[model samples]
Target chain A: MRAACHAPIRGDFTGLRGLEWDKMLHCPAQAARAIPTISAATSMSQTRHVFFISDGTGITAETLGHSLLAQFPDTRFRNHRLPFIDSTDKARDCVQRIKDAAIESGIRPIVFNTLVDPSAVAALREADALFLDLFEKFIEPLENELGQRSTHAAGRFHGIADSQDYKKRIEAINFTLAHDDGVSHADLAEADVILVGVSRSGKTPTSLYLAMQFGIKAANYPLIPEDFERNRLPVELTRYRGKLFGLTIGPDRLSQIRQERRPNSRYASLENCLHEIESAQRMMKREGIKWLDSTAKSIEEISTIILQEVRLDPQSY
Target chain B: MRAACHAPIRGDFTGLRGLEWDKMLHCPAQAARAIPTISAATSMSQTRHVFFISDGTGITAETLGHSLLAQFPDTRFRNHRLPFIDSTDKARDCVQRIKDAAIESGIRPIVFNTLVDPSAVAALREADALFLDLFEKFIEPLENELGQRSTHAAGRFHGIADSQDYKKRIEAINFTLAHDDGVSHADLAEADVILVGVSRSGKTPTSLYLAMQFGIKAANYPLIPEDFERNRLPVELTRYRGKLFGLTIGPDRLSQIRQERRPNSRYASLENCLHEIESAQRMMKREGIKWLDSTAKSIEEISTIILQEVRLDPQSY
Candidate 1:
């Protein structure tokens, strides 16, 4: 059912009409509504070009496309994207490419800016595309609507026992404890589940996966030498011994995922990553906390196993 | 991420095995590799008390709970759903309660065996909680592969071209041709955009939304005049069309969606659900057509809107 996004927003009016846009000065919302009609009234309507552009992998533009289609169900789409490059030149190039296509095909296109580069945004403005700048308008409303978020997970351990889910729930609490999300936590007792892993041990995806797929409410904290040197779980973790779960990965694969995210960074090197994975494994063993090696396993497998093994299942929707 | 499923099917223990299993039988595939081990393990693992059943409104177990997470990415979850109800008495009660909970929860609970009855399935077997049975096994598999499917549908419609997307691609050729998987023809072409409106239009979710979403190669065949003369859209439409979208509603709501479904169904009268919805809406808007009502909008909304605007993003993983 997945399809490319190609629908135009029908935003600007390329039509030459003195009275067509008189409705806009009356109310911006109404003006926005009239845009589609005015454009439909003119030959220029079919001359526009549309594209879904982004500065960050274009994920946001894809989302905006979904939302726009929801608004205009009948409109046909002609989608295009300029990947990785975030220059005004790229943006203008995108506009021209789409324009060329529209001229040939007789269909206008809309440019959806989902986090396009700041400068590129200006380029879109100069282009003849009907651009709908989403990032600028979405942030505050999204923030206010969602409020302070705890976790963005959705699972209810149905066939799985409550106890099994709860185990994962506690482990997630600990994982969350170890990770930082601009939140403050003074002690392990305050944690629901704590995650212990050496640096780059697939912690973030595993933790997020746990919180999301299983609603384990996970937080991950990287294990470093100081804690191992002391031969102890973090001081905070001692108070919530039952709530901790550990994630480990094979030395080689651990290095790969990290390297991709941050190439050549000291932390992402195979040697460094392997050192941490090994040390974290030893630390978990010494501490008697059960852990799993995530090297070969998919993140889903790793997180779900942790969720089940640790038995932490947060029930909130 | 999707590769794990094709992991050469090695027969050994999987990550699912908890710490307590005997080392010799640790590997699930390997342990089960031999028939004796399977028999022994089967005998040893006693049955449990609960059964969670669902007389499906229509969805597969895996796709329902797990896939539901895609809609709200931020909501974390710990979900489990039992499979087909096995033949057992104790299972029925368990199934009933869970079914009740599901009804209350208001999400599109996944289902299997559209033709089977939960109670009847229980009767087929004599067990404690047979009502909820078919689903028990899949939970592990799903958990075992969470993140692989869970990037919030990360790249569902990435990089797809508009012309290639189903709606635009399949627009003109919706001939009443029989195809596998129960889709029909007029249902196809007439469905280039088909809105199955029930009174008050039910927002014509089932049919219209699907067109909007995936471009499922859509074809919407309205329930017009044959039901009206017999009055439905023309009989030829039934014989040949693209997608058939359906919109239904509560008795009172029927008037509303029906007004939109066509704004006219003699069957839309209050207290006449059987005649209006079941009869006109059912009895095959045309033979072998799928539908949804405004009353069933939430579910249809899930099916329709999702199917309506599929962003043909290139596969992310």
Candidate 2:
């Protein structure tokens, strides 16, 4: 089956309703194939050199490349990123590197490029590899649809062109940094959203992703043992109850994550994880707050769900 | 002019050249168009609601929206994001919210959606807005080209399917957090690349971006005042000279940035910024280190250039 198989909304798929923590971990595909694979060739596939080359941040190329590569699970990949190759000479150097990688791996490297400059793109095309030019593939179709030619820009996708947008993102990032880990609740009023969770519950990364990607001032507060013991929301968070979003993790997963941070301690114990998660969920339910599980989800999934729930303005940072 | 106009590599365009600090700030676009506009419509435009509705992170929708909106700078946009709308009921709520936005603003809102679920997409189509379904627009053409039907997956784009890739990214992020700001250089050899820059030269954000986006275990070390006085590379960095990539900024811009952090102090003074930048540049030149200016660049640009220069394996992290 393709990796892009649709994960049916099996658990608490209710829209805008209370997103259950446990129900969110349901993976339909995993249930269909519960047994581990015993294929020997899966481990012996030739390691191919995959390159995500771009003329900007290389983020789009990486994202697209990863999505495509995820389809072939048996193929072993060694990825090398080549970003901001705008000049012809840099492109030539990139070609040399690709050739070297191909020689070292004894297999032709796969190149995924979004180069805007024709000269640079041409130089890399000469390399011995299965070259995939994303811009070359889609720009023509888009131009035909829009009835206008593309600018062939290099840095505009994620560049600092609009100072206003740049300032908003920077301000949001700084705000997130300042409000991280319940560091300060004095300026909670300024926050667009406040995330509450126990330690190692994917709060920090989710908060940063929301700030960086959507320009939302996301402030995260850790629900410590004291907060769980009190059996109530903190006084600072009481005023911003409407902006509160909760994150919970499975006890097993939470225990493993905490063990990495603080090994052989009460905090890392499975019992402690279960206790904290149960208390946090009870408090969240009592206070009428929506929650989601972070154990089976990525930071992108968590942040996207939060944004959908709150309906915050993405461009109003 | 669209903000997507290609930035011609005018100043110091040579590939991997000296990369002079002051020369990097020469933005030709700014030169061609200077001074704030006295146009009154810029501030008085009617505010319009924009929504990037998706079943994923809404990143692609946001990118397309921003690029399209850049062509019409006079339009004041208030963007709200609605992601992970996988059910028909949630789609109804989204339509209601869109209608409410139109009612409040007295203008039909603009909605850019990439909804994968057909039922959800249908419900959203009933909303009173300029609905642009990016998926519906291009999916058929892509299907025809590939001779295969798309999975119509909702979460596959950003889902946690490949546990290995997810683990590598999380590990890289952990490594970056542990090694931030020269906190611990004990495991510096494990880093794919090490960034060296003076204070506030955009090291932390760039380091985090590299780690999170490309799965590169990036470590950054700040060039302190004593190092500048000594006029030599730090002892800890000398061992990883080949892994070193320097970041420099224009003195005036550096002073302005510093002033924001420590207002009205010697650290933010123009003289101090100039001295540090000059000394840092001289030291970098003497050591034959390749550097880029962060004065007018974004973290994305800085990180992209570093990746291109170092050619680190993105998947090895």
Candidate 3:
């Protein structure tokens, strides 16, 4: 059976609701042959039903398909997508077709409409077929899953605003970094972007993403206790204020991340993590360092926000 | 008009195609109005026709949606998702309904599909609409573009797979390298993850991606001439070989990345860059280190592959 799941609400199946593929039957087709398969009662050899529905896009559908196939590894996922829908009529029509197809095919597969009209959702629920809500279930929860952020930094923004020249920024950051490998403080003046974060606020990933993806040079430094002891944004940052940006995460999140590494170090202690976050944020505000609250955001989101915020357009590469 | 151009497959919007309310386009009612703003001529109103599309759930799509909305600075995105469709038939049907509705609404907006589906792609193209093929245009290119790969050094297999844990590996490498302000190399062992890359291979952003998204402690280091000259990984890496990973880029890409920085540095010279890459690759092979080619691959793809290769399942988060 070509059973499928989709997310119309959120791209990448992040918002897909219910039916954790992990827990789904791995070999639905094979399972059917087994005495206890979900559809074993039906004696239809041609009982192949493909159901596609999403809260958003088909990403989760694809992912879910993979898991379902894992249960039934022999299944093939035929790609499909429906741009966000805005009306209930289409959704209603879709539900009716799905319900009918399920009965006819004897597969009883579920369909996901990522952005079906709420009325459409009502229609599906009323159809007596299992329907997964990609929005309320999956997407929302993933977004709220707070993870520790990194401190990797990208090169300062490069690219001539007119030319979109990011190449130079990447090279400069690379050269500056290479030439001054052990000289972190020496090249502060050459940086297009420098990251400052309390412990690990996701500086490194953003920096690497910028360089690798956008061809921007990015540098990052942790806000160690010593920096706070001195009560400054790294004395070197004073020389290049425009290029500096700060990243901060919620104290609770920070502590959890630390605990993962050190387990029980004083620094990894929740209280310590909270103290560090509070201190770093205050320092950033006082130092007039433009910063981002990265606690709730994904790396991609954080990178975009920082890049847009810095507005550092470099040219020359 | 909402003008979006896909680089790979030429975009010819002869007319409106369809809209899928995705995760970002949370309000279907709002998305109904938003899709047309891009195509709206003089008819201006408060309605936003922004939409987000995903296969299963709004998970990843929601992130992109939020970022896009944030990009407009002043503009708003009314996001929605089209639910459930996994085959060409459903895609076509959904697209047809969307095209009809878009015309009535006067919003001819671009559709972004994260999941790559040739059939749906063909249908979307046939509809004379703007489509964003995330994998085709955005993702696959990263793999070919990376041109270089990273090496597994410090944690376990070498250092990447060791039972010593992540932080210690990072700190060991860091401690080996000298830093000012009492930032002891001894503390380098604390890094949850470490990224090593040739200049311009995009270490910064990848590090940040992990840190920000996964809250993994990360550190990044550059692969320099002396290390290459000796055909060995950095000395600091010896202590934590399992935790170490390398990133490399193509010579041409390196040149482009470098020229942007120093414009004329000998290191950025194509000849030098090529030599550096060859040496790095040879050394990695000799060291029996595992690595990923960074050329042509975007940070997201690279991160995905490496995280998976490293057995760090992103799904856990």
* Candidate 2, position B16, lDDT: 12
Q: Best candidate, lDDT-wise?
A: 2
To one decimal place, how large is model 3's interface RMSD in Å?
22.3
**Model 2 chain A worst lDDT window (10 residues):** A10-19
* Per-residue accuracy of model 1 over B17-84 as CA lDDT, tens digit each: 11222211111221122211212222211221122233221112232222222323454332443322
RMSD of 2: 16.5
Model 2 per-residue lDDT tens digits across residues A48-146: 777777766666666645655544455666666665566787688777767766666677877777787899888888898877776665556545534
- As a whole number from 0 to 100, the lDDT of residue B50 in candidate 2 is 73
Worst 10 residues of 3 chain A by lDDT: A150-159
Residues A75-190, candidate 3, lDDT per residue (tens digit)?
Answer: 32222232222345545545554555466455554443344245545655656444444343333322232121211111111112222333343354353334232236765666
lDDT (10s digit) by residue, model 3, range B1-317:
11221001101111223322121111112112222232433234443443334333323443334432332334433444432233466467546644643563465444545444556556655553445433343223222322222221111100112123333333332332232111234555766556666776777656644543333555667777888777687777677655665667779988987887789999789999998888876766565444566665434445543443233432212
lDDT of candidates 1 onward, in order? 0.40, 0.68, 0.46
Q: Which residue pairs collide in model 2, if any?
A: A314-B79
- Residue B214, model 2, lDDT: 67
What DockQ does every candidate get? Answer: 0.02, 0.10, 0.03
Scored against the true structure, residue A146 in model 1 reaches a CA lDDT of 31
Winner by TM-score: 2
